[model samples]
Target: MTAHETTLCTLFAEVLGLPRVHPGQSFTGLGGDSIQAIQVVSRARLAGLVVTTREVLRSESVSALAAAARTDDRTRDRSGPVTPPRRFGPLAATPIMEWLGELDGPVDTYNQSLVVRTPAGFDAPAAERLVQALLDTHDVLRLRLPEGLAAPVPAARIPEPGTVSAAALVACVDARFATDEELPALMRGHMRAARALLSPREGTMLRAVLLDRGADRQGRLALVVHHLAVDGVSWRILQDDLRTCWAALASGAAPAPDPVHTPFAHWADLLRAEATSGRRMAEAARWDDVLRPAPAPLAGVRAPGPLDPETARNTHVLTLPPEFTGPLLTAAPGLVNGTVNDVLLTGLALAVLNWRRDGDGDGPPGTDPAGGRVLVDVEGHGREDVVDGLDLSRTVGWFTTVYPVRLDLGPTDPADARAAGPALGAALRRVKEDLRAVPDKGIGFGLLRHLNSHTGPGLARRGIPEIGFNYLGRFPMGDDRAWSAAPGHAFALDDADEGLPMAHAVEVNAAAHEGPDGLTLNATWTWAGNAYPGTRVRALAEEWFAMLRALARYTAKPGAAALTPSDVSLADISQADLDSFESQLGELL
Candidate 1:
């Protein structure tokens, strides 16, 4: 490798924590996933270099990446020390802290969307007004952070309504919404094209889109923000604020109250100040304990070959009935004094354990029925409890963390499934308490793990956890009347993709949907390609329903006897039997 290439390779090796990176080794071949890709991009960007993950994946050589990085104008200008933007306190949340904590790098994978729907009497002028209102509301939307600790300069004016690209408009919606097949391909296509228009120097980390389907009759306004700039909560805030702004514009009124809180830069400043004050290091050490690296690598079975490109993927959503959900909500106050999230997490853990055990033919190999341990990676909501009066319902920041919780299932009694609920609940409560005590609430710890390149084949294995749980808050649904007014809006919003896949790798998401009746638990799972087949997933869902029913019965009636696996003859229930059970349950509910 040339001297420059050698220098770059050394930096990569150090930053990535790889023992040694060969000049010709592919990043993906080295097992680089989305998380790692982000790390590489962030680090490279910080070092004044521009290199795409795809290039690194394809080149498979540090020397080539170095050459590309050097020639690329994006990385060459480290002219001066990067200065951070001004800190806005009340508005400043922890999401900005995490982004600033990222070792300067370009973002590789981007999860972007545009929520488009026709508003009543919405037109091009109104759309432009809404865009301007968005710019006026959130400081980050119009501020550009070039370096560290400096005032954020205003971003360029929003493009004209008609001039806005189609793809840009589509990106404002969530991935689940945008994945609909009926939507015009142009919507998706234009989004990708608009994303390409982003200047690496803009450090946008996110973008926006506006769509005017037609004059006054149909129009859609979307903000295609990058994952880096905000988190789920932040998006909700933006959506709510945008609606408020649009309403004002629709009525020929001025935008509502100005945001007075600290900006993200303030959080970044706090992180820096804390890092230097030794608080960050102490916090890091505390995380080291909570996130103690696993002794054994995660177990991952090698794929026989490439995943089937033609494999059909479909998502089915299950909502807990009132009878089942009501008690949990009532008991939530006493159980760990937790929110609905804790209850859902406990249920999910139990579901996973049951699913894993049920999947083993007779029993898991090489272990007694009771000795098998199941590891689950629970996705955290990542908001710091210390943030005074923080309105998670509105603030924006990618404040999510992932923590692995291990459950010893060896002694778990399949015969007494009702008994498992309390144990599962206890484990979740313990994890929650342990996490809350951490200085940074596991955010810094999570970032370090990702940055340090700790999870991989050699450093870590994958199969330790039979399942993953992510509880996203209430899904957003724009005003139906407003949505219908948009012309050419054909996409249907559903919770089909909310479940974990049937494969070995499963992620169960319990999304809350605000309905006339109250909160509905829209649960879905995404399974790994190999680990879960359709039959197995369907069975697990049925089993979960049965378990929930038993728990509800036991909880409601003190003298009721707990049901056993034998009592229900669950093993004998075929796919058809499960389907019938589900149908009956639906009818009864």
Candidate 2:
């Protein structure tokens, strides 16, 4: 290996915390996965070097790779900031509450797509105009952080509105559209690239990739925003705005509707005020008590170790039909005063308990036999009740938080699954009330305290909630049938779609969808391979569904008749069976 290659190898090893690696070692060969690859690139950038996944994949030797990286001028950091290309309007700022909300943890959920066809009759000038108009219409598109927050000089300011040259825009697009395989890598690269370029010190981050398909109309623009800054709702807004802006440019008209919310800075100030208040202190104390430390890593599961390639082998998604969701929602108030989310959580908890009872052999033999599994972490929408009226939908901030909701399954009687509805409902109400309490609702403060010395080392060592649950708030994209201005533009996104990373533990998400009968619940669980066996996962899902169905029924017909596991067919209970149940339930609703 040449000196440069040796240096690169050493850096990679250090960043990845591997024992040793030679220059010729392939990234994949070194046990690198998407998450690890991101860390590799991030470390390289921090060390003042640039490296692309493609280069890492193709190089025969470390020397060749080092030479390629050296010649790849794009990877090299220019000493000075590039002049901010022209943006359309005043910069948008993140809100304080939203910023506090993000304190909980990093958002691994990401959605990305490659749009291949440019609008019909699209021209370079028109494209430029379209982008310019977009900037003019949304403050978020134009934001640039000024210097003074731990910086020696004022940061580069965004160029005057309408000043970005078509060449620069095209170059950005061309760089991104270089290849199909390159798109995914490019998407990950931009997040790191933008972070370096934007010098993001606080709040959630934003990144984009515009692949120029060349003059003939095959270009792709890949946009990825952190979940904290935007949600499915925000994406719908962005999609509509983009289509509108593109159509207007094609027809020679102006863009429509400027945004109407205060900048993120105003929100950030509000968060600071709220976080520092006496009320916040009390709330923090409550959270501290409620969120006990996560138990030791489950048996057979290693603690936050390097991402293993084996873990990525299986990808599966389990969706509930609309029929199930409809009835569940209708019966929610009576059973647990639960929203769909509460019902879902309760069901999941019961399912987990049953799975443990069934002795799936996925967990360690000594796991609490009574299923007193603790430290359940559920993803939460960090938007506190306090921000009820704020038009957060239009603002750019990370408004989601991940909070821990402990579940004591030991006391839950498996035989009394029907009667468990009220208890589960009460538990959910307490969670909602605690979560809504102003001072302690912010996940960020909780995280900050956990990281600080003042909170005691045990708090830091405990790790955030173990099992994560997130409901993407009912899949809002219309019917599954694809719709785009051009043919084949409609791509189906499913649970197996690439992008979002899974946790080392279990991650669950639920969405409502229309099925043959009615609205069904699509629940997905992406489990860490090393941590869970397939049978265990399957059993857990089945039990959860059965429990939920029972709860829904109990809630709807309180004091009428109680359902028992014996009443249900345990012998035939399966994931597919549960799905069918949900489908039928949807029709009832």
Tens digits of lDDT, candidate 2, 43-129: 454455566544553355566768876432445577977643323332322232222222333223232222333542344565555
* Candidate 1: residue 228 lDDT (0-100): 45
Model 2, global lDDT: 0.46
TM-score of 1: 0.55
Q: What tens digits encode model 1's per-residue C-alpha lDDT throughout 1-589?
A: 7765665676566534456877776554443332334335544544556565445544546777777774335335677796544533222223333333332333332334445565635655555555555544454443333442122323212222233322333233322233224344645555555556443235344454444444343335545555545555565455546666767766778756335244444544453333334444445444433333333222112222222211237334578776565555434423333344444544444554565555353465322333434445666555443344222222344556665555433454443654544444334344334333444434554444433333212212222344556665544233345532122321212111122123225556665443435444567755555555766776666666565554444444432222222224466643335445656766798
- Misplaced by over 4 Å in model 2 are 1-229, 243-252, 269-274, 293-311, 333-337, 360-373, 385-390, 408-410, 418-447, 450-458, 477-504, 514-517, 555-589
CA lDDT of each prediction against the hidden true structure: 0.45, 0.46
Candidate 2, residue 553: CA error in Å?
3.8
Stretches of model 1 off by over 4 angstroms after superposition: 1-109, 112-118, 142-220, 272-317, 321-323, 326-336, 359-373, 385-395, 407-410, 418-440, 447-467, 476-504, 516-518, 528-589
